[model samples]
Target: MTNSIKPRLLLEIIAVGILAFAGVLTKTAANVAFPAMMAAFHINLGTVQWVTSAYMLTATLVIPMSAYLQRSFTSRALFLSASLFFTVGTGLIVGAPSLALVLVGRVLQGVGNGIAIPLMFNIILMAVPRSQRGMMMGVGTLITATAGAIGPTYGGLLVDRWGWRMIFIALLPLLLGSLVLGLVTIYGERRPARQPFAFLDYGLLALGLLLILLAQNGLGEAAPLVSLAEYGLGIICLFLFAYRSTHTATPVLNLAIFKIAAFTWLALTYFTTFMVFFKYVFRPTQ
Candidate 1:
């Protein structure tokens, strides 16, 4: 901490951080509520698990679009949209009578999260002074980490007392606070891209991701041949998506960043570690 920071500047970061935190918290907390959710809907474990899957899948798909979103829209617009999507999704989840609606709500929440996460980093880099960026980035990461860290415990306690929907209900005030703070603190600045949307790139990417997730989710249950076909198709789609991204002039994702040897290795390391840990944590307890 070399130099002192402006109050409003910090508030701006706090606004986005809170939004991101809420999104992360929702995702993690809902996992603890799965048992309650299944009982409430009279569904089995596999079926109820889609609540988390729908949310994660939607978030994963939307994440790749974040780079494009930043290029096309103002930070203020994006944050506001995120807030709205999240709020509406929470509402739907709280009021849902059927599992179908719950899944839809989770998907909407995922969309909000996917936007808020990248947008948080975008804002920090764009708004925070270079000297203070590291600290602010840490603050942002702390907010996210804290949310995920305590989410399971928080959900467990709340679900035990007030039921599964209470997990979302508890977030209403936080969501409103974020929206209000965003209105006051978030700025409107746009640097629109001058490039055509490459439908093929995003199409392949989305299809690939969907296939991969579906195949993974259905691994034990689905027929061997079907699973193999899906895995094969998914890999091919991703390969095409990557090839197109590298070769295109206005790529949705800048694959060039991975050209840095250190960065590529670090990313792979992080991905593999997170995947292993994630499976361990999310595994169904027998």
Candidate 2:
């Protein structure tokens, strides 16, 4: 909320970055332990895949709600809640006996990450002036995404040394530190107002997004017709959500922002590079 760099604001951003790091870190960290988890839980590969799939799907479904969440809650409250979710989630996985509990923990962590990632960008956009936003985002992105690059290796080392549970245990201190720092640094919002949540819009968006992703995940597994039908329905739901956003007084998400060419372009670049490239493009199989 300042034109110039402020210590308090810097600290707040740091707190947000920590949440991002933990979220991304946990995401990839869990990957390296799938085999171990399978053995521990006596599950098959498809079932074990749900460990990551569930977390990712939960995160994806929760992401669209970020706009609604930020509007409804304070920055501090959001940050604190995010940190707490992750910390609690970590604790669950650290001692979880069944695959079900581990999935529950991952989903909780996903919720925290979904809330935290967008909240960081929201802060930079609202608090930092346009002149400084790019630099701030660069710093924020680097800090947040760094954990992803190191996560597998970090997890491998921990799993090698102390077993899969150590991966979660290792994160406990950082998550706790982020929790305390967020409480001290983030103050809900600069100014606050109450607005009713747009449930129908959220429902449409969440359903559409979930269907689309599920279709993708079901590729090569389900009948071709089923996947196509799911994908088609997802598109229809999204179209209705967009139409409602334009027609209604208060849609959960402001789809109108895509009208801005620069923003839309940047969004597409991010989508293709992060969401599509590794997963779809350049894959050995079609």
Candidate 3:
């Protein structure tokens, strides 16, 4: 029994690692192609930055609903869907005839990445034993961090050697393999009845995404006031989302997670670290 379980656990770890790689691939591809994208589109630095910023904004806006999605779909179904979305988006970027289509592809890839990361964690927690969960979690974090660290360098190399389209093309096999493995290993593990779709959640998500888009566009154009207003509206939507999440019985995001002291502190730390990093990166040097 132990021998058999070991192989299965190894496979699960490999699957999670691959999923993390896919998430990192999206970022790597974008970073690698950013300079080329600007040159090809004849856009300035600020405009080209949107290629990455838009993806992040979209991902952040959608990530809050991941818990609801996990409840509504089987693991296999969700993983497959994420793979397909990511692969299709990658294809779009590869075959894009215009900058607009490329941006659309980036947005789709962002959604896939946003969904896949949390789902990977959920699957690991479900499959791994309690006694070994800590080890698995550490491994997962290491995989994620390693991917992030190497992503930019790999992307730069690919873009330099084969042009920007190769970055997208490179992801196709990984996504397909992940889809196949997920179907084999994770299918039929759980069958929660799908709940009725919530229109309110969709509405709020759309509004939030729209605000992010507007803000990105405004910022690109150097319209600080317009960007500020757009971001302000986005904050309002987030507050509304928080209120609905907490007060409603069938909340999209489980607000109760924030009540855990550890989670609360982690969230605070993450926010501070992100702000500090961004400030350092963007600050003008003398």
Candidate 4:
């Protein structure tokens, strides 16, 4: 039993590792192609910023609902859905004639990324023994980090050689390959107990996140007073979202995770570190 289980865990790790690499690569790689896209699409930097924001916001909004989705669908079903969304989205972006269509494609990719990321982690935890989970997670992190580090340079080279659309086209084979592995290897994976999704939980949570992200992104573009008001409104919506999440029996955002003091502190630390690093990095560029 142990021998058989170890090989299965290895296979899942390889599959999930590819997913992780693709997720990180997608974000970092697209960033480098922004200048090329701006020139080709005949758009200003601000307008083209939506290319990244649309994907990020969609991913952020979808992440909170992942648990609900996992419960509503089988692991195999979720994996295939993620791959399908990613593949179709990449195709659309590659062939898109307008910024609007590109944004739509990006949104689809973001949804796929959101689902794949959490699902990959869940699969690893379920497949690997507890003793090996830490090591495997470390390996997964390394894969993502390496991909991220390489993405900007790789994307730039591809864009320079073949044009901006090539960025999306380049990943087609890898995405399809991951899908094939998933189809073959995801058999006998765990299934979740069925749960009916609540509109209140999904809707408010997404609305709150969307408002906050938009407000933050608009800080530099909007007038000072308007920005302030938008920020205030976003905060209010977030507060309401938190209240609703806690009160609801089946909270989509899972506020209960904050009950763990360690997680709360760790999360705060990460947020602060990110903010500090972001300002340090982007302040000079601006």
Candidate 5:
């Protein structure tokens, strides 16, 4: 690459990496801050957990729809929207008076996060050359992995010395830098022609995912029978979604990826890694 192009590409990668790191940090930090949040909000463990679980559900729900969204929207537009949603969510959480508002804030942040993660990957693929793609991906992984590794420790220190809100507050400068750099560097992708969006398919997929997350959360908190019923309903909806993907012209999620053996193995590996990490992180400190 030319010297001029190299600097520009570097800046773009840096911008995307920073945002990804911040998003991951936000999620992991909240995990550590749960006890403090519960105490301050005057809520029980079951209720306080909605703060994190709701965000996870919202983010997960938004991801499948991203393929269509990226097709219909400009990269700049998507980045700006993501930044706005995240900023407003952070502001709300920082100033929220009640648990409800905090949950709302978390959902908005989740939406922003959902949009931002895919955009980060897409940007690297679009802007970086094929020769450099692998290197850039490694950088992306490093940023996210480092953030995930350190978030709880950082959050714990802040929570102990200051408060939970400080976590969000401390993140503001990095978030703002990301927004500014994104606005400056993320340009040139023209919007694609809008495709017909299948509302019913999307609704079914979203509802299915939502119920699954809710049921997962409810396992110990809700009665066993109620949890079982919710889990059953979620499974039914998911099966319907899988069936719809086969029949529909433009399914929100392309289930065909599952046909690849490597993809399935990769997914299983991710799940196993997450479970191990979660157990390690949340195990009793003693």
Candidate 6:
């Protein structure tokens, strides 16, 4: 029984790992095409970078809402829907003849990727035994790091060989395979639905994303200080979000999670670690 259970558990881990890898793949696939996109669209680097920036902006804004969605929908349903959205978005980008359509596709991809990432974490927590949680987390970290290490090089090679559209094409099979596996192996677990959604909080999140987009567009060699201001404004908006989330009845984020001392300390530690790692990884001189 123990031997049989081990193999089944390994299969589950692989399934989740593949799904998580798809998310990283989507993010990295576009890196090589960035320059091509700018040249083809006749847009400046700052404007064209929105292809990446918009995805990130949308992801950041939408992630907080995933808690509510998770409450209402099954994991299988959420995973399937997110995968479909990502796949559709990639298809659109592959076929897009115009810049506007490309941007639209990227926005959709961002939303899908955003929802999928946190859901992956949730899946790991729920599926793995407590005794093995640390091991699973280590596995996840390794997968993420491996993806990051290779993504840029791989993307560059693909773009050099096949052009920008090829990146989108590359993702289709992976997404389809993951979607099928997710449906077959992942069971739906239900939870009570969240109460009526709050419109104001949603609006604020949208505004914050817009501000981030603006900041990303504005910040470059041509206008560094102005871009900084735009980014600063976005940070302010995030603080506003925190305040509103705490005060409102139908908050988008559950502030109650921080009430636990362990949760709070862990969150702070994670934030610090993330900051250090990110700075080291992305240092300008490097």
Candidate 2: where are CA atoms >4 Å away?
Answer: 1-3, 129-131, 188-191, 276-286
Local accuracy of candidate 3 as per-residue lDDT tens digits, 1-286: 5313366556655664686677765564466576787778888666676777767776775676677788888776777777777778888888998888888988888788778778777766877777777777787777766776676666778888988778778878877787667666666467777776556865776687689677866764757888888888877886887777787777767779988999999999989986774444332111
In candidate 3, where is summed lDDT lowest over 10 consecutive residues? Answer: 277-286
The residue-by-residue lDDT of candidate 4 on 1-286, one tens digit each, is 5524466557755765676577667676777677777888898777777877888788888777788887778878888888888789889999999989999999999888888878777776767777777877777768866886787777778977998788888888888788878877776456568887767767766776677666776777747677677677777777877898888887777788899999999999988976674343222111
How would you encode candidate 5's per-residue C-alpha lDDT over 32-104 as one tens digit per residue? Answer: 8888887798887778778777887888888777888888998878888888888889999999999999999
Candidate 1, 159-234: lDDT as tens digits: 8899989999989999999899889988776667645778889999999988988887777885877888899999
Q: What TM-score does candidate 3 reach?
A: 0.85
Clashes in predicted model 6: 0
Report the Cα lDDT for candidate 3: 0.72
Ranking by lDDT: 1, 5, 2, 4, 6, 3
Candidate lDDT values, in order: 0.85, 0.81, 0.72, 0.76, 0.81, 0.73
* Per-model TM-score versus the true fold: 0.95, 0.88, 0.85, 0.90, 0.93, 0.82
Better-scoring candidate (lDDT), 2 or 5: 5
- Which of candidates 2 and 5 is the stronger one according to TM-score? 5
Clash pairs, model 2 backbone: 1-127, 74-188, 75-188, 76-188
Model 6, runs deviating above 4 Å: 1-13, 191-194, 220-236, 255-286
- The RMSD (Cα, Å) of candidate 3 is 3.3
Worst lDDT run of 10 residues, candidate 5, spans: 277-286
Ranking by TM-score: 1, 5, 4, 2, 3, 6
- Which residue segments of model 5 deviate by more than 4 Å? 2-5, 282-286
lDDT score of residue 17 within candidate 4: 63
lDDT of 5: 0.81
Best by lDDT: 1
Top TM-score hit: 1
